[model samples]
Target: DQQVKQNSPSLSVQEGRISILNCDYTNSMFDYFLWYKKYPAEGPTFLISISSIKDKNEDGRFTVFLNKSAKHLSLHIVPSQPGDSAVYFCATQRGGSEKLVFGKGTKLTVNP
Candidate 1:
């Protein structure tokens, strides 16, 4: 089953603009949602995350919003910078589980 999906394969944004990445999941039992950024040939790095119990979580310029009703989650990057360019993956894990399920990925490019 395709539990997680990223509709957009790529997104482009100009520096100093907002960048939004979207993700959808079919599993309601998922307790946590995470967004990871990966550079080419490099391992994915944790970007931001949100819990199912919370509607929104923010850290600096990155914010994650979760809508349990629609089973949707999105990551918002404000004033996107050139350094923010990378492939983004959406992931989820249920309670008491160590395994993480990830979507294919969405490549983000920020142009100066």
Candidate 2:
């Protein structure tokens, strides 16, 4: 089963706070991991990604950490803004292709 799991259905945080989203996977063959941010009815857009070989990757206010041994990963957004309120999906790519298997998604609400 190629399933990525995001246990939390939603998260709420105050502005300028940190928003952390967690995800888990059962497949060990997955080598690439990605995080996508979505708003409303629009499609998810790429946020950040980390390979199995690395433990941490960061881009500006977004950071993603991966732990292959535990088959877990997390996304951290520091100083969250109102604009950060959206659905965050954790995805994984198996083998070589870029096709991704997504989690249920976590809705992040950053209150101003």
| Least well predicted 10-residue stretch by lDDT in candidate 1 | 46-55
lDDT of 2 by residue, 18-75 (tens): 9999999999999999999999989899999999999999999999999999999999
lDDT of 1 by residue, 1-112 (tens): 7999999999999999999999999988999999999999999999888888899999999999999999999999998999999999999999989999999999999999
Please give me the total number of clashing residue pairs in predicted model 2.
0
lDDT of 2: 0.95
Candidate 2 colliding pairs: none
* Residue 59 accuracy (lDDT) in model 2: 98
- Residue ranges of candidate 2 with Cα displaced over 4 Å: none
Worst 10 residues of 2 by lDDT: 93-102
Q: In terms of TM-score, how similar is model 2 to the real structure?
A: 0.96
- Measured by lDDT, the strongest candidate is 1
